[model samples]
Target: MSFETIRQVKKFTMTSDERLFALINATRYILDKKIDGSFVECGVWKGGSMMSVAYTLVERQVTKRQLYLFDTFDGMSEPTDKDYDIFGSLAKKLLQKNKKQEKSSIWCYSPLEEVQQNLSQTKYPTENIIYVQGKVEETIPETLPNKIALLRLDTDWYESTKHELVHLFPKLVQGGVLIIDDYGHWQGCRKAVDEYFEQNNISILLNRIDYTGRIGIKV
Candidate 1:
C-alpha cells in the first residue's frame, strides 16, 4: 500500500507512520506465513492500527480471520507509581486537564461507537471484527481468542500491559508476531514486558522499530 493510503489510516491512530507500516507488514507476514488464528490489539484507542490490519487483509483479498479490538474507550486508566517517565507526566497533565475541563478530558477518549464507525468506513468485513469494550484486566480472558496470529500491545501502562501479556501471550501461536508499541517510550510498559519475559524464560530478541516500537516473533 502507498504511504498516502497508510496516512489515511493513521488519522484514526496515534501510531507513527513507521510503526503503522510495521503493523501492516506484520499483518501481511502472518498471512504469508499461513499462521492460523486471529489478529488482536489491546488498547485500541481510535482503531486506526487495527484498521490498518483490516485494510491489509482486504488488500490481500483475505478476510477469514477475526480482528479483535480491546479498549476502555473512555481515555486511559489511571497510571500507578510503576508507570513513570514520559507516560507519567502525560497522565498527570491529562488528569489536570480533566479537572479544568470537568468533562472527562482524558487522552484517547474514543467511544466504542466512534471506533466502530471508523472501522466500518474501511469496507472491512464488519462480521470479522470484534470489539471488547472494558478494561483488559476485566475483559481479556473471557473475550480473548483461542489463538492469536498477531498480537499488538499499546496500553502504555505497567499493570494493563502486564495483564495483557499474561493472558494473551500464551495464546499466541508459536511463530506468531508480538509488537509492543511503547517498549522504549514508557517505563511501565517496558518493565511489564521485560518482567513477563523473565518470568516466562522467553528469550526472543525484540527487533526495534524506531525508538518506541519493538517486534519479535514467538519461537
Candidate 2:
C-alpha cells in the first residue's frame, strides 16, 4: 500500500504512520503468502488499526479471513504496579487516580458503539468482523479464533499483555506475524513480551517498527 493509502487508514487509529505502514505491509504479506487464518487485534481503541486490515483485505479482494477485535471498550482496566511507563510515572498516576475515584483512563475510552460505527462505515463485510468487548484476559481465550494469521496487541499492561501472548501467540500459524504495538514504549508491555519468550523458551527476531512497535514472524 502507498503511504498515502496508509494515511487514510491512520484516520481511525492513534498509531503513528510508520506503525500503520508496518501493519498494512504485514497484512499484505499474509495475503500474498496465502496464510490460513484470521486477523486479530487485542486493543481496538478507535478501530483504526483493524480497519486498516479490513481495508487491505477489501483492496486485495481477499474475503475469507475473519477480523477479531478485542477490547475493554469502556476504557483501560486498572493497571497493576507491574504496569508502568519507561519513566514509571504514568502508571503511578493512573494507580493514584484509581484510588481517589473510579475513573477509566481518558486516553483509551473509546466506546464499543463508536468503534463499531467507525469500522462499519468502512463498508467492510459486517459478518466477517467480530468485536469481543471485555478485558483481553477474560475475553481472548473464549472468543479468539482457533487460528490466527496476524496478531496485533496494543493492550499495554503487564497482566493483559502477558495473558494475550500466552493464549493467542500459540494460535498464530507458521509464517504468520505477531505485532506488539507498545513493546518498546511501555515498560510493562516490554517486560511481559520478554518474559513470555523466556518462559516458553522461544526465540524469534522482532523487527522494529519505529521505537515503540515490533513485528515478529512466527517460524
Candidate 3:
C-alpha cells in the first residue's frame, strides 16, 4: 500500500498524514483477518479515512460488508455541559477564524455533499456505503449496524464520544477492533473514553496506533 495513492487522500483530505496512515493500517488488518461485520465511522470529515476503507475494500474485492459514514456534515455540535470544561476553554482561548465557531469550538462541521463528492469522485462503491447526516445524539439511535467489525470514533467532544461508546460498543463484535482517534489528542475525548471503559468494566488491552490513535480488539 505504498499508496502512490496516498497523495490523493493527503492532497484533499483534512486529517494529518500520520492519522491517515494509521487508519489505513488498521483497515488493512480488518481485511487481512477477514473480520466479519460492517464498517462504521462516527466522524467522517472529508471522508478521507472512509475513502481509504472504501479503497481497501474495493482493492480486495470485499463485498460482504457495508461502510456506514455518520456525521452532521455541519461540523461539531455545541460543547455539552460535560464537554464545556475542556472544549469550551479551548474555544475561548483561540480566536475563531472566519468568525466560524465550529472551527474553533471543538471540531469542524463538514459538508455532507462535499464529502460525498470526494468519495464518489474517487470511485468508491457508493452503492454499499450509507450516510447518516445529523448530530450523533439524534442520528445514531435508529438503523445502526447490527454488528460492527471496525468502529472508528473521531468526534472530539466528551459528550459525543460518550454517546457513541454507549450506543455502539455493545454492538461491536468479538475480535472486532475499536479505534479512538482522540485518545491522546483531545482532553475531553480522552476523559470520556477512560471513564466509559472504566465504569463499564471493559478491560480490553489498549494499544497505541500512533501519537493520537488507539485501538482495542474486543475479546
Candidate 4:
C-alpha cells in the first residue's frame, strides 16, 4: 500500500482503542530496530489490528520484513476444560451433546473467505501478507518458517494458547514482542501463559496494556 492509501485508510477507518494503538506503535518501534526476522499474529480476528500494522509498515516504507497472519478463519476450536470451565457443567454437557450430534460442530464460525474479502478492500499488498488458515494446532507447526520478530497471540482458548506457546515460542527472535490479546480478559488464556512460562523455565515480563490485554517482550 502507498502512503496516500495508508492515509485514506486511516481517515475513514475506525480507530483502535488507545491501548491497542499504543501496542501497535510499540510493535512498529520494535520492527524499526532493524531486526533480522519477520512479523506474525497467531489469531487475527477480521484483520483489523494486523492490517493496521501492515499499513504502518507501509507508511514507514519498511519493506524488508514479511507480515504473516495465522488463523483458523473460524472463530475458535471446541472448548476444552483448560479454557471453558466457567461456562458451567450444563453448558459443557450441552456442548458435549452438540459434539455428539455433529462431527464438525465448531465449524459454524466465520471462515477465512470473509476476512480475505475485507483485506481485498484495503491497500495492503497481498504479496506482503501471508494468510495461513487452519486450526493452530494443525497449522502452526507446518506454517512458521523462521524466527519471528513480532509474535501476537490472540487465541482465547487455553489449549490454543498453550499449543502456540509450545510450538511457536522458540521461533521468536531475541528481541521479539509477544502480544497476548486475551491475557487479562480470559481466565483460560492467563492460565495457559502462566503454566507455559513456568514449565519452560522462562520468565517473561508482562506489560499489561489494558483490562483485556497484556504483552511480553522477549529479551
For candidate 2, write residues 1-219 as lDDT tens digits: 557666766666778888998888999999899898999999888898998888888889877779999998877777787877766667757655653322234357787888889888667888999989998878868887889999999988989999999999999999999999998878999999999999999999999999889998999
- For lDDT, candidate 1 versus 2, the one ahead is 1
lDDT of 4 by residue, 15-53 (tens): 236445755665676767766677888777666666667
Candidate 2 off by > 4 Å = 94-106
Q: Could you tell me how far off, in angstroms, the CA of residue 153 lies in candidate 4 after the best superposition?
A: 0.6
Q: For model 1, how big is the CA root-mean-square deviation?
A: 2.4
* Per-residue lDDT of candidate 1, residues 1-219 (tens digit): 747558778678778888999888888889889999999999887788988888888889998889999998877878877776554564555455564323224457788898999999778888989999888898979997889999999988999999999999999999899999999888889999999999999888899998999999999
Top-lDDT structure, candidate number: 1
**For model 4, what is the C-alpha lDDT against the true structure?**
0.69
Q: After superposition, which runs of candidate 4 have C-alpha atoms over 4 Å from their true positions?
A: 1-16, 84-109
TM-score of each: 0.93, 0.92, 0.88, 0.80
Candidate 1 CA-lDDT value: 0.86
Rate residue 215 of model 4 by lDDT: 75
Screening candidate 3 with a backbone cut-off below 3 angstroms (N, C-alpha, C), the clashing residue pairs are 73-110, 74-109, 75-108, 75-109
Show the colliding residue pairs in model 2.
Answer: none
- Model 2, residue 183: distance off in Å is 0.8
